[model samples]
Target: MNAIFLMLMGLGAMALGYFVYSKFICEKIFKVDPHFRTPAHEMQDGIDYVPTNKYILWGHHFTSVAGAAPIIGPAIAVIWGWVPAFLWVVFGTIFFAGVHDAGAIWASARNKAKSIGSLTGDIVGNRARSIFMIVIFLVLLMVNAVFAVVISGQLINFPSATLPVWGAIIVALIIGQLIYRKIIGLLLVTIIGVVALYAMIYAGPMIPLALPDSIAGFSARQSWIVILFAYAAIASLLPVWMLLQPRDYINGIQLFIGLILVYGAVLISGPEIVAPAFNNELPEGTPSMIPLLFVTIACGAISGFHGLVSSGTTSKQLDKEPDVRFVGYFGAVGEGSLALAAIIAATAGFASLADWQAIYHSFGQGGVSAFINGGANILQQGIGLDTVLAQTLLTVMVVLFAGTTMDTGLRLQRYIFQEWGHIYNVGWMQKAAPATFLAVGSCLLLAFGAGGDGAGGMLIWPLFGTTNQLLAGLTLLVITVMLVKKRRPMWYTLGPLIFLLVMTTLALLTQLKSFYDKGDWFLFTLDLVVLAAAILVSLECTATLTKQIKANKASPATDQP
Candidate 1:
């Protein structure tokens, strides 16, 4: 199929799913009544539950959903073939991701604006709440760790790129502080910030820094740990408006512009889809279809991480009625579309099947970073831009992307820790100081200990896929329970839930075996950690459902006549 045709098909499918499928489910079954005051409406605190304009909320939702995972997952999935990757992106977004995101938003809206963990407790059981917390905590840890590695790797490869990134970040911080906290004039600060960002990008190569010879030996992996811990510390200490919000705004704009340019170039250059629609030739013992493809492409289609963002951060900031579906549901569609674009770019323009394989083999091992840089080179050559400069620009862009995600992960981790403190009745530990310390300390220790050398090692690399997929599995389980509780049709939720459970379980087992065979004790230990958690979560979910069913049976009928 032609590029335009594919793009249209993918987008149309998502739109149809959103408007037709999502609307029917919400109206007929879940019966979301926007006119009815939500918890936020009843308790308008202006702090967390304040009503917000849909447009402003869109900014928040889109920024929260758009992160490093979309890029990484699709890029990696393309290793299987663009067909499987593309189909997953299309079908998963329509059937799975949209439902997951919409369900999370609606569920949150119905629950007095509570976090997903709290709702899981109310709808499922108290034990499920604890399991949800633990699962989300682990997921956040992996997010912070992997993104730390991602940013550090880019910075190491292109030191010059840091100038524009830091400049943009500082500008964003100032602007965010000004607008949200009214520390300064919003108009003046944003104008200055934008100008500074542009100048920094234009003059990026001119900046220089001296480094010791020892720095040359620094592992990208080790640098990730240091940078992550240090940033988490600062993020915890600072007000969200000053850093996180503004930073995300700047990063979001950058992401939008960069992606536009990328697709524009692809269109102008008329790059063809060079990879086969399907790679039916499987090597011995290879699993190309079904479970493997589904698990491998988890993020591109549906992700549990989106639920964390939706409930933890975005929902709290929601300001208006119409904003929920626009920000929450549409933003998810945008992210899925971005993944589709990346798959197209990666698979297009290669000379032959062998060339496609060569490109994939050469850059696929390093994950999204490798694929992004490689794809940038192709676009540059195809569109006649300077290869070196184009590659450098792409590198910086991705670093900024990863930085935004890590920032969110750090904040979420802090909140999770503080909540845990409250749950444990450690009132003294409920303050931001201890929570911030633990969050930052945990991230740094894991990042550093996962691989002392900055190279990120194999230990941290493989966990990205497994941890992310496991989170998706957990999310599906929770959503399924919510649907059952709401008396919605069980078939839709149950089908995907069961399918994802089996796929994720097998994927986890595969990862455990790979870890054991490689003799990587650290990853092996992580596998064990996730495995134990998975077992407990399964038991909790099953037990909770059983109780609910029995309770329903025992309840007396109101009037039999």
Candidate 2:
């Protein structure tokens, strides 16, 4: 297929899903009542359950939904060609992600401001609640660790790109704070901020702070992991308004602009999709397409991680009843569209199928920088631009995308640590200082481990997919339990849960085989860690369901007395 056809197909699929399937079918079946008194309305707390405006909530929800996972997963999925990735993303978002995200918001709203963890306890049982918390905590840890490495690698690969993106973030935060909170002039602040950000982009190469020969040996990828951890530590401790919120606002704008540029390029160049549809065989020693494709494109289609963000943060800030559908369900569709855009962009650029295969073989696993440079060179040839500068800018854009996600991950880790400490009655963790320190320490350990090899290649990538899918499976389980409790038709939740369990379990087994085959003791060890966690969580969930069933049966008789 050509780029134009693919783009049209993608947008059509999204529009059909979002407007028709989501609005007419799912809403009618699920009976989503916007006027129902949500938790934010019933229990109005300024801190957590405050009702927010739709526009501001959109900013928050979109930022949280769009993260590094979406980019990386789709990028990897395209290795199998844009066809599978594109189909999964479009269909998955329509059926699974939209449902999951919307369900999280609805569940939270019904539960009177309780988080997903707390809701699990009330509906699934206390045991399942504990298990859910542990799963989420580990998921956040892995997320923070992986993203830190991703950003650090980008920074090192393209120093020229880093300065402007970073500068944009810094400027955005200051301007956002001054305009929104400090009551400064919004129009002037925005204008000045945009101009400054653009200026930094042009001036980035002229800046003098290049990596030294000795430090440069650290490898751009490895250094990023450390830098990511350090940045996370600070971000976790700051007031959300000061850093996290404002920074995301800025990053959101950049994301918008970057995406527009990419789409414009696609339209201008009209590159054909050169990757084959179902090339005769899979990559060497690969698993069959059935489970692997689903597993590979986990984030693009339907991510359980989205549930965590929805229930943990976004749901908490939902100010009104109607906003739930837009921010939760629609936001997911937006993310799916972004992933689709990436898949199209990657597949569409090459001159011919042979050229595409050659490029993929040479630099596919080298990371995003290589892909961007390769794509930039293609664009330079076809569309006359300074190849070096375009590639540098592309690198910076990728890094900034990864960096924003890392910041969110770090903040989440702090919350997870604090909550875990509180649940266990750990005195030290009850204090902010101790919790922050613990979060930082945990991230640092992962960073160091990920960076152990000089190349930082193939070290963290393998772990990211399995752990991510497992988290998604766990999220589905929680959502299923909630659906059952709400007395919705059980099939909606049961069907997806069963499908996810099979896919994720198979994916984990695949990882185990690969680990054993490679004889890499460290990865083998990590595999064992993940397997144990999965088993424990499953048992906890089973036990909780059994108890709930028995309780429901006994309740009717006791009421007769």
Candidate 2 local lDDT, residue 49: 55
lDDT against the true structure, each candidate: 0.67, 0.66
- Model 1 C-alpha lDDT per residue in residues 4-66, reported as the tens digit of each score: 566667778888877887677566645666675766567766544545445445555666666
lDDT of 2 by residue, 370-488 (tens): 34755575456555757766676566656665666666666566667777777888877777667777877876676665447333334655766666667766666666665544444
By lDDT, the best candidate is 1
Task: Give candidate 1 regions above 4 Å deviation.
Answer: 36-51, 181-199, 206-225, 280-290, 349-352, 362-366, 378-385, 455-461, 546-561
Output the TM-score of candidate 1.
0.86
Sliding window of 10 residues with minimal summed lDDT for model 1: 208-217
